[model samples]
Target chain A: MSKRSDPRLIERVLRGEHAAASRALSLVIDEAPEADALSKAFFPKSGSAQKIGVCGPPGAGKSSLTSRLVAHYRKQKLKIGILAVDPSSPISGGAFLGDRLRIQEHAMDPGVFIRSLANRGMIGGVSYTIFGAMHVLEAWGCDKIIVETVGTGQDEVEIGKVADTIVYVTTPSMGDEIQAMKAGVMEIGDIFVVNKSDLHGSDKALSDLRSAMSLGRTHEAKPWEPPVLGTSALTGKGVDELGKALDDHWTHLKKSEEGRRRLREQHKEELSLYISRRVYRSALDKISDRNLDDLVEHKIDPASLGTKILKK
Target chain B: MESKPFRVLIAKPGLDGHDRGAKVIVRALRDAGFEVIYTGIRQTPEMIAQTALQEDVDAVGLSLLSGAHMTLFPQITKLLKDRGLKDVLVFGGGIIPDEDVAKLKKKGIDQVFGPGTPLTTIVDYLNSRLPSVKKK
Candidate 1:
């Protein structure tokens, strides 16, 4: 648990050495010594790769569409990294990361590196280790990095904190789910994709998404409105348009510098989260288990007890 | 960083269609606070080993219900060992008989767990082998 990250390994990764990137990433996820050093080493050279978040409800073909998006990027001869965040079972700390199954054909391609992160009970639809994984990818010179989120509830807005652009994919029959999203989660998408267009009611899904995106949205204050495009990842329909839409969003970010600002905020947020967790955990370790029993017996109030613990 | 949650892969090797036991163990492993990667059914030894390599997981548990443990489990262990993954412990369960269990251990499987094995029996077996928790 206290393994020091081999600086030689970090050095190999910096030189774009083979297999070193994955090894560095393993250390990153394990929270080994190399993670901090690796982060510090690569962050100054970060912000060069574009980070995009693809999210929606389960069964929305999010993975399929992601495959198409990766193909599109690879055609441009760009290196790609995919971090598919799959929800962990609350009962068992296990997850079925089928995202790789859909995109496994590209497994051997040196240009593509796909790994799935078990959410480990994180509520933001992403694993806590995502930024670290992204760090490895960026340091390895990935041209584009895509984060496919655990298609859960409205919490997917967390992706915006990590990605430059957000693409929310849905199907023709997802109107009910979209209706339930209200304005909060729907407002997060920079581009809306109504996938499975070859199916019936495709038009209705597109209309439903467009209407939801337009109503009471605060982001419209900007010049760009979230565009709703239809795509069928199975037949590769409308994938090009979706790719174009992403390109346009990237161009806008370059023009407005919002991407750079968001990247800075992400780094700051990641650091703060790590600090809060470490500091709070050490504080908790100092508190006695007897105090927990006191709380159950109505012997002490939580606010006062928390304050006392922090003061220690 | 605090000690990481143990990462284990629960896979159904070969052409077995039944995943009920595999899924149940997945829950048990997860609840034990181990990071369980449940690779779906009918995976080849190649696919399972490659997945472990990419994820850099700590251990792999193959759920072999088809009585192919003699052939399937050893094949997977060999593949993993060939890829310089001898350190990645391989454990399994299913209809593996007592006699075959010894055969498997000889063929490189770290442990052979039979069906209905207590969750902690397996969980403890694993936790026992992890490096002792020495403080930084």
Candidate 2:
């Protein structure tokens, strides 16, 4: 385990070796502090990689769309990084993050780097692996990165906190929260997409998304209003347009001051999460099943126990 | 820390586009609590072998229905052998004949599961055969 800190492997990764990067990411996913500390060396190289988050409901074709984006970016000779998250193993509570890409297409491509992780093994539901992975991708010299979250529900907007540009993918047959809601996950998107446009209600879905954006809770005359686009992941329709829209959003972020502001927020959030995890684990270590048992039995109180652990 | 979860790479080799079987196995293993790494479809022997090595998975399950299993199965096995990844168990499924299955098992292919075999059999096979990972 002490040998996991060997810097030679990470050095290999930074020197444009994809296999070494793969090994580093595996160690990073396990939350090895040394591996993460190695990643911090690459922090200065970060903030340059374009962060794009593709999130949507289950079965919304997020994977296929991401595949299209990979192809699009590949055409421009861009080195790409993709962090794909799947589900947790039902029994062991281990993450079952699966690789969604057909390996033959891009596995051989030197310009593309792909890794999979899941939301399991979270410390108080805080994801440090992802943040570390962002750095790893940047250090690996990827020009752009696409993070596709495990398809969460309409109200889950965690992806927005990490990604610079969030693309909300939806199909025409999705629920009403995306179209007409007070404050659902739909509001977090910087670009709205109605995938599977070949199906019925695609027009309605697009129109409804546009209407929602008009009355969007965050649509308060901002410099960058999100564009609603229709796409068919099956036929690769409108994918080029989607790519263009994402580029436009990137342009807006850079042209205006909001992009830097968002990056600042992202940086702060990331640092805050690291701090919170450190504190959480330290505090958690001082706790035991006995403390919970005592609390449950009314032998001890919650407030005092917290203070006692903190004092230690 | 306990043990890392058992991770499997479910790969499809050759031009078989039918993923209904692959997906079924994916869900079953996921439900049974194993991380399934799927790199995509129409993969080559090199891709599967390299993916297994990179992911450091405990096992590799190849699904091929293109009648190329006789070639693809042993090809993946030989690749794994060449990479010195002999510890990584190799199993496969899809339209293979009984004779080919025997031939594959002889070629260092661990097991060949054909159609109509219960998903539970594959699940059980994996559970019993593969070693669990060390977790924290």
| Best prediction by TM-score | 1
| CA lDDT, candidate 1, residue B110 | 78
lDDT string for model 2 (A252-303, tens) is: 9899998889898888878887788778878988899999999999988999
Candidate 2 per-residue C-alpha lDDT over B6-91 given as tens digits, one digit per residue, 9 for 90 to 100: 78889999998998888888778887778888766778898888777666677899998889988888889998888756678889
Q: Write the per-residue lDDT of candidate 1 for residues A1-312, one digit (tens) a residue.
A: 434345487677767643577677887766665578888887766778889999899989998899888899889888888888888777755566667767766655678877878776678778777888888888888888999999866555778787888998878887654573575567788898888899999988787777765664684386678898999999999988888988898988888877678878788868776887678778878778899999999899899999988888
TM-score of chain A of each: 0.91, 0.91
DockQ per candidate, 2 decimals: 0.34, 0.37
- Top-DockQ candidate index: 2
RMSD, each candidate, Å? 3.6, 3.9
Using alpha carbons, what is the TM-score of model 1?
0.85
Q: Determine which window of 10 residues in candidate 1 chain A has minimal summed lDDT.
A: A1-10
